[model samples]
Each structure stands twice: as C-alpha cells, then as structure tokens.
Target: MNAGAVGSDDPGPLVLGPMLRYIGETDATVWVETSRPGVVTVHVDGREWAAPTFAVKGHHYALVVVDALEPGGAWDYAVHIDGALVWPEPDSAFPPPRIATMDRERPTRLLFGSCRTTVPHDREGHRTNGVDALRTLALALARGEEEWPDLVAFLGDQVYADDTSQAMREFIAARRDIDKPPGEEIKDYEEYAHLYQLAWGDEANRWLLSTVPSCMIFDDHDIRDDWNTSWTWHEEINRTSWWHERLMGGLSSYWVYQHIGNLSPSQLADDEIYARVLEAASGASGADRVEGSELDLTEAVFDLARRTDRHPEVYRWSYRRDLGDSRLVVVDSRAARVLEPQHRSMLDPDEMRWLDEQLSGDVEHLLIGTSLPFLLPPGLHDLEAIDEALAMGKHGRIAAQGAEKARQSIDLEHWAAFNDGFVEVFEMVMQVARGERGRAPSSVVFLSGDVHNSYVAEVVDAKARHGASSRIVQAVCSPIRNPMPRMVRVMMSSFARGLVRPMRFVAEHSKHVPEPAYPWAVTDGPWFDNCLAELTVQGRDLSIVWRGGEIRDGDDAHPVLTTVASVRLPGPSGQPPGALGWASGSSAGSVS
Candidate 1:
C-alpha cells in the first residue's frame, strides 16, 4: 500500500472523535467523524490502519478497527485524513491518542457516570449545575497528573434528545420553525446528529473520549423521557403525530453513532444491520476519497431500527464482554422491554434468558452495567412493585386505571416494577454467587445511574442458605452535569428516609407481592451531587470512590475533583461489611 502523502497546511478530517472503543487483546476500534470524505487513518506508534468514510443523511463517519496489537501494550497514536495530520489539535493542551490494550493481570479501573446535559461550562454553567465531572477528569489527565481508567461506561442519558438545551433551541430557532410539530425537542435524524455533536463535541471531553475506550447504553432520554415505561405509556406516545419520525431518527442515529462502537469486530460481523454497511462500503471500494452516496447505508439501517422498535423480539441490544478475569455485561433495560399490559417486564423473555446465561461465569469480579438500578432502596422498590401490581389489576379495573395514571405521573418503571424479571436476574446472580453454576466470583457489582442521586447499597440476604459468599453491591453515580430541582431533591431525601418500613409493611400484607427473598437499604448515601463513580477491581478486593466536580475561585469551566464518599469490600473468604440499617440514612444534607 502507498503511504498517503502528508501536507502541513491541509485541513484535516475529524469533527468528533478518535474515540476508542472495544479494545481487545489483539484489536481495537477507533470511531471518528470527518469534514469531507477521505480515508480515515489511526496511527499507533507508526503502525497505521485505515477505513473509507461513509455518509448517512449528510453526516460522515468511519470506524477503523486497529488490529494486531499486543496484549497489555500501550501506544501513543495520531489521526490523519487523506494523509493530513488532524488529531492532537493545533497547540492542544490535552494528551494525544494513546491506547492500552486489555491485560488479564492488570486491575480493571473504570469510571462510570450518566445523565449529563449539554451546556457551556462557564461560571453560569457552574451556578446552574453544569460542572462536568467527566470534563474535569479529562483536564486532569491532560495535565499529566492522573492515570486514565481502563474504560468509561456511560450508563445512560448521554444525550437528552427529548429535552432541549438553550444552545440547542437557539440552533433550532435559527434553522427551522420552533413553533412547528415536534417543537423544541429533536425532530429527526438531522437534529439527533446535532444533539450528539453537542454532547461529545467539546474539546476537553472529546480528547478524553479519544484516548479512553468507551461503552454506552441508552436510557429513555436518548429517545424521549419515559420511553417504553409501560404498555400504556407506549400506546400513548404512539398516538403522537411525530412519534414515528422521532423513533426512527433516534434509533438510526444511535445505531450509527453510539451502538456500533459498543460492539467488537467479531460481534459486528454478526450484526445484520452493520454487516450490510460493510458490504456496501466494500462493493464500491475506494482507497482514499469517495462520494457520500457511494456507500450510504441509512435506508436499510433505518428500516431495521423501525422493525426492532415495533417487534423487539427480532433483535437483541444487550451485549457482554469478558475482560480477562472479570466480565462486563451491559444490559438493555430500555428498548428490549416486555410491555404487555398484564405481563410487563424489564426485559423480554429471550433477553432475560440471555442475561441469565451471561450471569454465570468464573471470574474474579463480575460487573453488571445497567442504565437503571437493579436494586433500588427498599422503600422505592416496594413502591414501584405496588404500582406495577395495581396497574396489573390486583385491584379492580377502575383502581388499576388510577394505578396506571400514578405510574406514568411518578415515572414508576424500573427493575423493581417488573417483579418477575427482577427476581429472575436476582436469583441468577445469587445462584452464581453460591457457585451453583460456576466458581463463585468474589463480588457481583451493579454499576448504575439515572436516580440523579449517588449512593451505595449492599444486599441483606436474610435467606442465605450457607452464609452467601459473594458481596453483592449497588453503586450509583448520576448527572455528571445535570442537577435535580430543589423540590425533587427534598422529595427524594424524604423517600430515602421515611418510607421503607411502611412500604415493606404494605408489601408484606398485599396480595400482589410474594415476600422478597432479599431486602436492601442505602448504607452510604442519598447524596444529591452531580458526580461520577470509579471502581478499581484487583484480585479479591473491590474499592469504589465517588467524585464530584468542585469549582474553585470562580473557575467554573475547570472544576477539580473532590471525593464525595468511598468504601472497600474484601473477597468471599472474608465476611462482608454489615449493612447500616435504614435509620442511618444520610439524606438530610448533600455530600458535596
């Protein structure tokens, strides 16, 4: 192959990332968006891999899989478009492209967070709650101080396609009629593309994304708030005139942008929708530059997305990865839901079976990343279960209607609401912990967000048959930038403190619920701070730290990381820490 010529003055390709994705022992994927078509190349320590860029509805993207790297190897890399250097922006202070492949012996340190809104990170941004923890960490890495996490798992709500920011509204107003159908929120593929650009476009975060491998799962906000919360909710949304257009746009954009990067080359080969794109690209093969339509792969992808939305059983969005001695299972708690009125489930039967299989495996540590918390506070759990039960006609039809109304009003949809699905996954987790299927892992950790408050909770399995060996923990960090309203915060604090006993009592006597096999409570926090959570897993010990962004001396755009709370857990050989009872709840004040 001829080495592409480099020109110092030529404009480079890359509008967004050299974002790392799915780094394996032998290969890794780098995703990028470029202005004008050309061959997009990622160079690792002088070794180069290139892929032709393709267009979808006018936006250009390329996914270059850098293969044949040694395990545990680290390499500083660069990006070029049609032979012109692009990345490590001119006089850039941020670090350049560098990747460290997965190594079995190394401890997996990961940073996870969700629910960040797109807004300028200035003084106004800070005062209004846009002090981004992810951006702060990026700057710290840029300054050559902190080491990078092996991966950053964005749990959900990466972009609020349903909620419009002021900047986004301005853009919409300038280009189209804000008074039109679909209004201020995103309308179609063009708007969704722009929303992603807003979310990941900022330079500091962009650089962080370029270097650290990222995995994402979408929540309701990626399409619309309360998406598929219930069968009734789905029907209600379907009635809207623009809902079809919105769904098509959101899912298609998610496919091209977020979902593709989550899969490995091997996994991508199995994806029919993505497979067609590669086929299209290879058919009209180009070495360097190519016209947009030569490889456009939108229509086919959009058609599949529509079918998947309507008939979810046809496709599976959840995926699992084995990172050496540990395993990461990212669940699809949103789109793969079973939304039948009488049999609502967090996941469809097939998806649940898949999760059950993925749950059991021999590993030192098992991490389950879900957009919604698998285990909420006992009070919240019971409340959601009650709502779901009532909606299912545990009471009369009139009462069921009232329950459905309440469910929609309060957003009462989570794993707890779908008791059967929750119990199934929970049982599988416990079975694995007890070594029923394999050697019990040291810990089974659920890393989740979406509550807008951060906390740590440990399962209190009163029914353990042989003194449960594995430590089951729920760690949540939320709203890397967005802050809850004061009223909502107060309400959440009250829910955390005063309702567990009453709700549990209701569950005990209610005909709807079979008494829970295990109960849990908030042991560390109900801290309402816009923050991120990090976990370090090595051998039999697991430690978690929550960090919030703290702006100093009015430097809102450059907030520093401050520890909110932390805890450590030992292996199954040791006794797990005793749960601090519900009375120990610290909801009176925010942690930060």
Candidate 2:
C-alpha cells in the first residue's frame, strides 16, 4: 500500500488503480496526482528527484520530469509519496520496475488504455478489490514479476465528474447542492474537486501514478460526455448555468489534474502559466501558497487551456517525444477540435498541422495518442454514420438524436459519430501508413482506449498483411476497470463487427479512410473485463500481447481473476511464452 494515501490500519492493502501509464522519451517526465500534499519522487534506475506537486480543487498532483536520460536503455523506479514508500502489486498488468527506453538504441513497448469510472468493487464498496488491471501490473514490478514497459499511454476519460459513482455522490452531497438534476451530470467546482479526489485518491492507483512516467490525452468524460463535438452540441450544453460552471470546473481542474505534467522544460519556458507553475513549484509555497486555494489557480489555468488555441504557440496541448528510435505524438483531441460548423475538424488548423507533421515514419515505430480511436469497429462506425447522416434532415434529426441517445445508453461515442473529424484523423494516419507525405516508419500504430472492452486488431492492407500497402491494425485496452453493464458486452461486439466499415466509407468526409480500398483490418481477439495490451517493437518487428486477470477453479468459493490472454504478435523477435502465459522478450532491439 502507498503510505500517504491510506490512513492508519492501512485500509486493507492500498492497491493501485486504473490508468497505470508509462511514457518515456529521451527525457522521461512522469506525471501523476496524490491523495494529499507531500513530496512524490521517482527513483529512476538509481537517481531520484523530489518531484514537485500542486494542490488544486482538493486534489494533489505532479508531473515528475526526469531529464538527461539515454534512449534505448532500461531503468527501474520506486515511488515515494510523502514519507511512505509504495510499489505496484505482484499481479499488476502493467510491467513494472525496469523499462527499456526507445530511440535508435532499443525496442519500444507501449501499453495504453482509458475510460475508467471510479466505482467501488462490487463487494468492497471501496476503490480496491476485484481484478484491478493497473494494480496487477504495478504489483508485478513491486515484486519483480514482470517486464517493465517502455511507455504507457492513457487515452481519455481519466476523471468522470459527470458519471460519478455512489461514493462520489455522497462526497458531492457533503459539499454542495445535488438537489437539481443538472440532471445526470456534475455541476460546479466543488463537485468537480471532490470527484477528482475519489477518482485518483485511491491508495493502490496513487502508487502506480507516482512511479510510471505517463502520457495522457483527454476525452469527453474528462469534462462531460459529447464535449465540444459541434456547435449545436455546445449550444445545447450551454443552455444551463450549471453547464458553464461544470465546464469551467472540469476544464479548470484538468489544467491542474492532467495537463500540468505534460509540459517539457522548453515548453514550460514558453508557456506563461506553466512557467509560473514551475517558478512557484521551485519556491516554498508553490501554487498552494500563490492563491487562497489551489482551486483559484486551477480555475484560471483551465480558462487558459480553453483559450490557448485561439492564441496559438502559447497554449498548445499537443506534445512530441523522441524515445530512442520511436516517436510518440500525444495529441489533445478534446481541446484542439474545430467543432464550429463553418470548419469542423478533429483538430484545429494549427493543431492539425502539428499532428500532421508528426505523422511521418521517421522513427522505428510511430505511436499516435488520440483519446478517441482514429478508426472504430466497422459496425459501430457505420451505425454512427447512419445516425449522423440522419441528423442532417428533418425526420433524420429526430431519428439521429434518438439513436445517439441509444448509443449513449450503451456508451458508444468514438470516431464514427463525428464522421468529418474522424475521416481527417484517418487520412492523417493512412498518409503515414502509406508514407506518402514523408518517410513511413517501420510500424504505424494507434494506441487508444475509451470503449469498455480490450482487444488487439492489426490493420492489414487489402492485398498484403505486411507490405508497402498494408492495412493498419488497432489495439485497444479499455475500462482498466470494468465499467460496462454485463448485458451490453455481446451487443457492443456485435455492433462493432457488423457496422464499422460501411459507416467509415460513407463518412469519409476528410479523405483518410479509403473507400472500398480502406487500408486496415483487425487481426487480434477482443477481451473485456479489466484488461491491458502490451506491444513490443524490436527493430522492424512488433509483438502485441493482450493481458487480463483470471479466476482460479478452486482455492476459495469465489475464484480470483488472473492473467487470461497473452495473444503474441507474430514476430521472430516476440517473446517465448512459458506454459501459463508469461512471455520472455526476444531480441526485438537493435541494441546489444
């Protein structure tokens, strides 16, 4: 258990929680938040830093940037929060301890996922218990039971202030007016603040965040469902005074919660507010002392992120990483969208230009972190397209809205709905896949999670699985916590299998996904129930493995879920698996 997060008696054993991400670049910047104010440090290999964290809106968070790192080298880290030392759980799905960095030197392994609601375990009524994917991985490292991943990319829905749990609801009641039905969502800063606490303050997850150098991109739930998709959407939302406060609170808290740690020294040097944040953190009071409460500073910061795009080169949320031979482009899909009707785009012109530039295959492997999958399951994509097209006309509008509500009822908001924006991102990725605009890297992969299930799908070109014109495969690890209703599982898969392609074909407004000749297909199997996917890139070969928890046949009446699937990628360099599913790394690296 992490020392700081748990009170005495220790709250059982403080297990790690969702979004256990690792993001490594030439300069490794590990970002996370804690339950209370104290020093959070990462001991990389051997060296350590008393990373600075700030308090805002009742939560404590930090982005510990470890600079001067060598690419392709592996290093282990231990997390220290306040005075207590904490590590990952033994069965943690996240490979812990040491990670091999990527660059020109070694292979890059990226494990990513998202869309986790902070719900109590079915029996525990607390954050722990059940098969916690991240905790399993974290504990693996703590016990030296698994391989450390080079990086972990977290896509979307980090905090769901809107779809809060009962514990969260009670916490909200202690603070403010939950009397009104701002209907099904969170309303103000007070609510937003406590929601974040419930989301990240869990003991186990806090330890994971403190150690792994993580990268993140936000999605709708970070603020609310269907945020900033279109002008109509925004208008419909703004109809309530509660909506404005919610947006203000959500976005404001995000500045402190997720975005603060993503900045580099160079980036912060140029960013006014971040620069202020760095300066203040370097001093005694930090942001904590700068204002009456961290919330005051956070409120202003969120407004800055909201307005940064209108004033480019100042507040860009998109980031780039040079991790050995691999390059990671972490984009801010939510804030950067051009949702206005006049010119709707997945990313605004400037942000799009930045992402477009990073799509080249310059590195050994290219990883694009867009909260929403650039390509959704074929059936679901088509369904969303059908609904979108229907929404354009008179009767279509009613039908589309109703269908959208249905999709919402089942939690299906991905690239398919906003066909225009979806196509733009698809084109960008395909262009990279084709290496038309520039040098195409050995592998171009999209790491995403928002869907409640986990699976790996390799994109194969119509003619060849591994060739100049091969299709792209998508690997998804979702609901690091099982948030889907059991009944909806089969239905979600059926929809994905049935409707995606046709919808994508019709929704090809931006010219990315080729019609009839679209260049990617799914090759891996899908597995839901709190799982993660690990991809290892050694030279030109990429091996992807999907890992989850399992339940033993005997032992106790209730079988504990343990590692279930280990779908190995077809590569000479992929690891050799032992009987029960643990795989040993092959020489996938160009390094000695």
Candidate 3:
C-alpha cells in the first residue's frame, strides 16, 4: 500500500520490484511482485521481454529474463503491465531503472551489509538511530553523487523472522491472538510476506532495489537465532509445536522471493523442480496467457521448499560467481551445517567438498562470503572452540550441560566451534595462498556479517614468518540499520581483548584440540554504528571502506554518510604476512 503512482490515471500492477538480479554478460533477470496476476514486460534498450506472473498461495510474482544486451552497456529501462507503463511514476524522484550489463574489463564494486531492522524513517526513528545507511546510500546514488556499485550483496538478517519489531507484532496481534502459539514471531508464509514488505517497502530502498542488482544469503535470524547451532539446539527447536510450519513458511517464502533470482538462467533450466513448474506453466500457454490465466504453483513450490529444508544436500543454497578475475563463493553456513554430536562440521561433507572445489586460486581475488566470519578474532575463536570441546564431554556431565547452555546463550556456534571444518578450511586457504592449489590468488578475502559490529582481521601465514605471497583478510560489516546496545558493545570489546592470554594458554595445554596454524587479530574496529561496506576490487589490490549515517546539522530526517574506517590492502608485496597497512577514523570523520 505504498501508493506508488496511486493517484495517477494509469495505476501500475507492480508492488515490489523492478529489481535487477543475476546480471550476466548479455542477459539479466528482472523481478517484480505485482498487485495481481498479469503479463509483466521489461522494456530496455528499445526492446522488451515479457513474462506472465505466477501465483504461489495468492501472491503474484514474475521473473523477466532480459537478454541480448551489449556487455558493459547502460540503458534506462521501464516496467509495463499488460502494456501500460507502471514504473517510474510521474512524480518519481529517482532515475528510471538503468540496467547495466557486466563486462570483464570493468572493476567489480560491491556494497554489502547485514542485520537490518525495518522501521519508519522519521524524526523519532532518526533521533537515536540517525538514518538507515542503505536509505542514505540510495539517496546519494540517486543524486548521482555516489557511484553505483556493480551489485549489492545483502549477507544476512534481511528480516528478523524471530525478532519482530513492535509494528510487526502489532500487525500479528491484529491478525491473530498474540497469546496463542508462536506468540510474537512470524509463523507462516503470509506473515513472512508481510515481514518482507516491511523490510523492503520503503520508497527509497524500493527504488534502490529497482536499479541495483543484488544477491543475498540468510543467517540465523532469517529463521531464528542460533538456528542449527548444534544437535541439542536443533532437537530442542524441533520439539516446539509451531517450528514445522515456521520452517516451511520461512524456506518456502525465501525461495519464492529471494532464492529464485539467485539462480542463473541455465541453473533454472537445469533445476528439476523449477523446470517442472516452467513446463507446467508453459503447457497451459501460461507465459503468453492473458491477465487472469495465472498458474497456481503453490503446492509444488512449497513442497520443494519442504524437501530442500529436510534434505539440504539435495539442493544447494550456496552459489558462486566470477567477476572478471575475481571469483565470489557465497557460502550457506546456516542450513548446510553438520550438527551431529560426534562428527560436528560447519558444512556438511558434500557442502565442504563443493566449497573446496571452488577454492582454486586462478582468480586474482578469491572472495568467500559466509554469513558467519570464517576467521573470528583469535580469542573469540579459541573460546568458541574450547566451548565446543567442553560441550562434547571433555568436561564432566554437569559441566558439559553448562557448556551447552553457555554455547547456545552466547551464540558460540561459528566456524571455530567446528575444529575439523575450521582446520580444513584454514589449511585450504594456506594452500591457495602458497600456490599449492591452482594459480595463486593475489588475496583471499572473507566477507562476513552477523557479529552486529564491523571490523577487519588478517591471517598470518605461520610458514612464512616474515612474508607471504597472498594476503588473507576478513572484513565484516553488519546492521545496515540495527545498532548494538551500548552494554553489548562494551562487553564484546572487552571480552575480545581480555580472553587472549587465557584462550591461548588453554589451547596450548589442552590435548582435545590442535592449535591454529595461524593467528589473527582485530586490525581496524568493533564499531557499533549502523553501517554498510563497500568492497572494491581494482587491479591486484582489494580495499574495504565502512560507511555509516550521521546527522551533522542535527537534521534527524536526513542523515549523511561518514567513513567509519578505510583499509586499502595492496596485493602481497612479499612483505610480512600480517602487516595489514590500513587507515581509520571515528564514525563522524569526513574521510572517504
């Protein structure tokens, strides 16, 4: 009910997006959630591709594959529903959708952040929180002041299905009894749909999604906090009465909304479930059908979601992309986890094998995007590892129970919790860095979120004490709108620093686990401002700059971006491995 072009004589069917997605050399995917079932046409470069909307449980959506565009070409585009131009409303402030095709020569620039909570963009909302960084960045991009990133990667927590805001809770209460089962959190597909609308329904963010191509992967909050953390946690959650419907709804809606666009045209073609839907839709002339002849794919799609969630190995939520010489491997750390007690692994064996195969170093930059940081701060990493060990009966029964409670309470399930997986990935990274794999990459960068704070860390190759061939770095940006509490920030900072000696001491003395081959430290920050990160790959050097919102003139309604920190990581120059030359400033600094 955004009323986008509502007062106009020609009202549009589009409700959600002309969202640019999966941009390849000569083709791109455009998605839209419409008000009704209709034939949606994507008009670009004087050519148009049309697709009819499909309904899944009464929600109408369409994916238009626009093909045969010149590489690196930028063209303004429009959306038409049944031949009436509906997008770029007459009084629209942002520019029309400008679809840009990717070329290998162009530098790959990506803007990424996670853990955003949707709220009104008003004086009250901005007083303590300032403005949402994504909204501010969208405005700047609209004004042509900030360069458009090649794509935006929303790492996780796109919506807090478990942690609902007051507004969302109010809506839920109105719909059903909040005193009933699954009181405050989302329970089904309809609730999930409304949650997405809350998250992306804002005018600025909506328009930004219209123009910028994006990819997303989910963290725990997308389902629930500490989702699939351990066998005990999984068993407990499964015992809950409403969890089945919640999981089904979460995964089903995610596929209908977010996951569909992540697949390439070929991938879609090869997908059996999607292919069946496509075949069925086409059989009834669904593609060329008139406005009312929509295909109801509710059962098939939802059934696929149920099957996928039940057997994660049967389908992959993880994906890989090649941008110029840089290969980005987006890991699905949540659902693909192997949580069996005796054989705990961060990734199931099949998922781990797939990731290892993707880790070859022929690309100039190997970027691994995991929802959880692959390399946590050393102290934090060791503590989580020790907790995992203790929880596995390294300690007595009572102490083990305490360890389990502590692990679930503090969210101790990260890469460090699974020592086998951590060691395998670390040694794999070392092999890639030292050219033992394929051609060595200039840098192996891990892009992560979900820690609720932004920071940078570097891995020191122990083999080469003085210097190493490849730079291994971890960059984290979180909470595009949500900020950590003051107490939580102070606690996390102190705990990160305070546990170093004790964690190392225990790791060295304990025979239950092997010590890490390399150690890392927090190089830049633990800043708690709501921020988004820009990671640019230029030539052989990769750099990250965190940007946050600020109110310089106390204009609560309009916040401007200030650099939180900037680190220009040059390709390994045979210098010391952990040199990590970087620059920084406070959140209000004007530094770019």
lDDT of each: 0.81, 0.59, 0.82
lDDT of candidate 2? 0.59
Highest TM-score model number: 3
- Candidate ordering by lDDT (highest first): 3, 1, 2
- Model 2 C-alpha lDDT per residue in residues 487-574, reported as the tens digit of each score: 5667666666766655665657523323423544554445556755677875766666655443344222222324435544432223
Candidate 3 residue-wise lDDT, 1-592, digit = tens: 2235322333347767778888888888888888788888999877899887888778888888888899889999988888887777667877887899888998899888888887778787765454699998888888888988988888999999988977789879988988987999999998998788778877788889988998889899999899999999989999999999999889888887888788787887787656754664575555423346777777877787788767778888899877776888899989988887888988888898999899888888999888899888889999999999999988778878998999999999999998888888888888888888877888888999999888899876533762446888999998788877677788888888899899989988999867887777777777777889999987888788888878766676567767788888877654456777788856752212
- The prediction achieving the highest lDDT against the true structure is 3
Q: Write the per-residue lDDT of candidate 1 for residues 1-592, one digit (tens) a residue.
A: 0111111133245666778988888889999877666788888887899887777777788998889999999999888888888876767766667888999888888889899998888887777765788888888888877867888999999999878888788777877888987889999998887788788878788889989999999999999998998888888899989999999999999888889899999888789876755765576454422354446667767887889998887888788877887889999999999888777789888888888889885789889999999889888888889888889988889988998898888888989888888888888888877778788888888999998988888877522643556778888988788889778888888876787889889989997876767666677777777777788885788877777767778777677777766767666655544443222222122543
Q: Estimate each model's TM-score.
A: 0.94, 0.77, 0.95
User: Which wins on TM-score, candidate 1 or candidate 3?
Assistant: 3
Worst 10 residues of 3 by lDDT: 1-10
Q: lDDT at 166 for candidate 2?
A: 74
Instruction: Point out where model 2 deviates above 4 Å.
Output: 1-3, 6-27, 30-65, 69-104, 121-130, 181-185, 281-296, 305-314, 341-343, 394-413, 458-471, 498-519, 551-592
TM-score of model 1 (CA atoms): 0.94
